[model samples]
Each structure stands twice: as structure tokens, then as C-alpha cells.
Target: MRLETEMKMLQAKSQAGIVKEETVGNASRFIDVSAKHTKLPHFQDGKDDLDIWLTRFERFAESNSWSRDKWSSSLCALLTGRALGCFWRLSSEQAQDYDKVKLALMNRYDLTEDGYRRMFRS
Candidate 1:
């Protein structure tokens, strides 16, 4: 009965244009409704370099003309393993800020300013 009422409320919200409705292609699957859907390359730890991946993502975002406000959410979709975990560890507000999130990811992977300097020196 409670679930039914919640479903009805959700349906009403969808009808009223308060919530966007997403089409399901197959069996019902979870989707991150808050994110604006876009295809982005996933970040893999160990196998891939974070700095290179970040550069590629920035170029891709610029090429697509994606707004800075949408970058954090869109980028969240592609995070995995330690990177995803790094994102999760941030406070909700920090998670919404792309620069903060990026810094957190870089720090987690030992890509700090000193680390970059070491790389350059090497």
C-alpha cells in the first residue's frame, strides 16, 4: 500500500513535468537520474594513467561544448574502482564541485603538484 502510494506520487510528478521519465529498453535497471546522460570513457586504475585520462576527458568535454556545471555529474558516471571510491569519500557539496573532485582523484593517485614536478624532472 505504501509502495503503491509512492509509485502514484512518482507518476504524478512525471506527468506534471517535475521529474523526467526515462524509457527502459529491457528489464528495469537502475539509472542515475541526476546525471545528464553522455558517453564518456571509463577511468581504470593500474592499467591507465590518471593524468592522461583527465587530459582526454577535458578535450572531449571542450569538443562537445559541455557546460562546466555539468562536468562533475557527467564525469561521475565514468569513475571506477579507486577513483570512484575517492569521489564517494568527498562530502556531498564537494562531490558536486568538479575541481574539488578532480583534485581529490589526483591526490588519491599521488598526482599532486610535487608528484607532477617529479614526473617532469624524470
Candidate 2:
């Protein structure tokens, strides 16, 4: 299977909520295997850590034409509120904190600072 397809499948499994032990085991296996092969530096360098993932995601948003306010809000709602924080590894509190930080960064930079944008861009 393609890497993107594999990643999507794993992400879906992770979002499906905790099930039987066997199911959890399978999801864990998929994540472990994917992490081992992914080319993303954050994943390869043992920095696929939650914070790093958030940083990378923010950077991706900044590079686009979308306004920082919209991007940050949407990301906080999508990633932290629904996907990663809700379905993946981070706890609710952690997710909330991440959203706060992302929003703060957006506000601080007025959405124009190259350094701020670069921090999360890629």
C-alpha cells in the first residue's frame, strides 16, 4: 500500500476509539511500523513527539495563503479538538494547551513574521 494510504488507515484506526486488546495491539503495530518508515524528520529523529507534530502542522498552515487567524483556529479545532487530541495520543488538557499556544503564536506574529512562520512551516 502507498505510504499516504497506510498513514490514513492508521489514523482511522487510531480515531476509532479504544476497542478490544487485540484491536489496540493492531493499531499500535501499525503506528510503530509506519513511524519506522516515514521520511518526516520529526518521525525519523525520535521527534515525532506530540509537540513536534503540532509545530510541523502549524508550519504547514503558515506557508499557504490562508490567514493565520483562520488557519490557527481551524487547526486547533480540527487537530487538537478532534483528531490528535481526541483520537490519538494527547490528553484533552494537552490538546487544550497546544491550541492555546498555537493561537498565541498567531496573535504574536500578526501572521507576518517569517521566523514565526518558519518555526512551524516544515
Candidate 3:
């Protein structure tokens, strides 16, 4: 009777282990729908975080086979704060234009003077 109970307990533990292994991969998988919207690094204006955001965005674009224009617009979805409002005001027609969106973002979020200095020195 003891050996039978121990065998049943081992079987239950093995089943639980299999379940955990299967769930680990599903939990970690990320779907990049226009940069995964939620995962885009917040680009607060004048912060030293655009480089980080750009690298992540680039990876997202490549993984999802998105064009620069698509990236340009989806980027608007990731905006927060005053920046989010700025993108919202864009006319649907204007929003369809990638250059306009990109230019607007660059104008608002251009790096600080220190960033330029660092660029020139390197």
C-alpha cells in the first residue's frame, strides 16, 4: 500500500511539472502588434530615453515586418502626456502622412544640448 501511494504521488508531481513547463513558454511569448503598444518605452520630452525606445521600436518593426511609415504612425499610439495630445490633434489625413508625424515628434522631443554635444564629440 505505501509503495502504491508513493507512485501515485510521483505521477502527480510529474504531471504538475509538465504543466509548468508548457505554461512558461506561453507566458513569456510577446506579440508585437505595432510595437506591442504597451511595451514601447515612454518617451518623455527632453529625456535621455529615445535611444532606448528607438532600439526597441526597431526590433519590433523588424520582427513584425512593419514599414517605417507604419512604425511612424503606430508610434503615436505609444505617446503619453502632452505628446499624446499632440498626436491626437493630427487630422486623419495628416496622420496618414508618416513624414508629418515623424517631423512633429522630432521637433517636440529633440534631445537636450548635452545630447548634441555628445554626438559631435563621438
For 74-100, candidate 2 gives per-residue lDDT tens digits of 554444332333333444454345455
Off by over 4 Å in 3: 1-39, 42-48, 111-122
Q: Per-residue lDDT tens digits of candidate 3, residues 24-72?
A: 6455222223333445566665563654665677787677656665776
- Candidate lDDT scores, in order, read 0.81, 0.46, 0.61
Query: What clash pairs does model 1 have?
Result: none
- The TM-score between candidate 3 and the true structure equals 0.46
Q: Which one wins by lDDT: 1 or 3?
A: 1
Best first by TM-score, ranked? 1, 3, 2
| Best-matching candidate per lDDT | 1
Off by over 4 Å in 2: 1-48, 80-122
RMSD of 1: 8.2
- TM-scores, one per candidate: 0.64, 0.27, 0.46
